[model samples]
Target: MTLEGALIRSEGLSIRHGGREVLRDVSFAIEAGEIVTVVGPNGSGKSTLLKALIGALPPAAGRVTRRAGLRLGYVPQGLRLDPSMPMTVGRFLNLPKRVAEEGRTRALAEAGAQGLEDRPLTALSGGQFQRVLLARALLDRPELLILDEPTTGLDQPGQAAFYQRLEDVRNSLGCAVLMVSHELHVVMSASDRVLCVNGHICCEGRPEVVAQAEEYRALFGTGTGGALALYRHEHSHRHDETCELDHTHGEDT
Candidate 1:
């Protein structure tokens, strides 16, 4: 997608954890107001790539370069709110940073967490917690927003509503979005571009284009709206001419 800025580029990014090579030669670019989704099977380093983009995990190889003064807002896989933390949703949103009451209210309203203002952080459900986190991220009015599996634990309705809210916020703010997700159909439908990663980038292109790639098939396999062919199929049968030949010899044929 065309953006005002130069680009957020990762040139040949790689990562290693405990001496194990997790991601290798990974690279991609995202632009302002663009939504990019990184998809792959479990343990394929999808989240690792996101973490690297946000500086949570430094790449063992390659580098991530972005525009100057690019404010980033991150929504991790899940919020780890302690049950003992005595904080309301409103107060929690302002932790370690100051935000005007109107701003907080507006953000929460946009994220559909308005009623949760007075509620304890622990009292919210998965969807509610995610919304509040999104609101918190919006408080900075960042130029870019990064989400890791942002739709996890939400029902179909909740997922749809969340995406609608995000779209509204993006339209008004004109901020770029980079989200990691497992909801294949939803991600493919919403993202501007798709980056398929399995230890490395299998393919990168528009959703339909990448989805049809041969590498996508080899990586995501048949479950991704394509042929169900796999590297190998397991079976318990063998029909060979060698066995028939042996049988004929034994039978004096």
Candidate 2:
């Protein structure tokens, strides 16, 4: 991807944690008004990469650059709440800072939580809680939105609904979306691009292009379609084997 017009871009980025290198020589970019999904197996540094991009973890090498004065919104995997603490959804959004009623209303509405302002934080269902978290992220009307495994605990239908909400958020806010998700088949079917990372980027391209690759099709299925289809087959591949596909896109990428 071209870094010139990208909202955020990483150049030869490397990261380490607890004295072990987790990611190395990774580079990619997310442009405005686009949706990109990062996919990989467990312990592959997908979360670490997001943390590094958001400045939660410092890179061991290279750099992450953002456009001037860019406003970013981030939705984390989950939050630990004190069960004894009583707080309304609206009140929770104002924590560490406060926003006006108009902003809160708009954010909740955009997040598909229009009438949840008065609900207790602990009373929400899994899907409702996720929507609230999404609403919290949208409070800033960010130019870029980031989420880390946003649909982790949800079922198939819940996962599909959450992804649909993501599309709505991107359309309404006109912001670029960068997220880490285990729901690869669900998101890949709708994403503009996909990044397959295993500590480092093994390969990346438009979902259709990568899905159509004979190499991938032979192992993963014909394509990443129908949210539940990939569940029928096992998704296991040796990263070393597909690392060479990085150049497979070449001039087209």
Candidate 3:
């Protein structure tokens, strides 16, 4: 795919932690208004790649380029909030950066947490907390919204609902989304493109094509039969772009 005017581009990018290389010679580009999900087994450098793309980690080799003054909003894999410290959702959103009341309310509403403004952080359920995190990310009207496993603890129904909200957020904001997730079914169902990464790019393409690739099958098996069932149900309602799929069988990094 032509990645002209890419929001972020990496060429032959390599990353290292301590003495071991986490990712090597990886190249890809995230264009504006695209939803890209990175999937891999644990310790496959999925999180490392996200950090590199967002400039939280410097590349040990090659380069990562971002659009000038790119606005970024990141939702981490998990956030620990002290139960003893009293903090409300409203108070948390204003921390360090105070946005207008109208903007705050609109952001919360868009994230499907409209009435949660006054709720204490500790009072929210797992799914509600994730929505709050998303609300916080949307406050800045970011150009690139990066989420690392945003739906970790939710049950199947919750995961599906959250991903739907995520798709809604992307549509309403028109921001490119780069998220790391292990929920194959949800990722495949919602992504515009999926990248199967295990230390390096394994295979990347549309959800349907990637699901059938041998490389992807090798990493996550066909247990996704249920996921595929869900995909067929959802697929009938949407128009998917027709693009040639790209598959890579690189040696593990």
- Each candidate's lDDT (Cα)? 0.72, 0.77, 0.77
Alpha-carbon RMSD, each predicted model: 11.5, 6.5, 8.4
- The numbered model that scores best in TM-score is 2
Q: Which stretches of candidate 1 lie over 4 Å from their true place?
A: 1-4, 208-253
lDDT: the better of candidates 1 and 2: 2
lDDT of 1 at 174: 86
Off by over 4 Å in 3: 184-188, 209-253
List, residue by residue over 1-253, the lDDT tens digit for candidate 3.
6767899899999999998999988999989888888876667788999999878888999999988988888888888898889999999999778999998999899899999999999999999999999999999999999999988998756765777788778888999999898643337355687776767776566766455766556654654432321111122222222110111112222
Model 2 lDDT vs. the true structure?
A: 0.77
> Better model by lDDT, 1 or 3?
3
Residue 200 lDDT, candidate 1, scale 0-100: 73
- Candidate 3 global TM-score: 0.80
Q: If ranked by TM-score, best first, what sequence of candidates would result?
A: 2, 3, 1
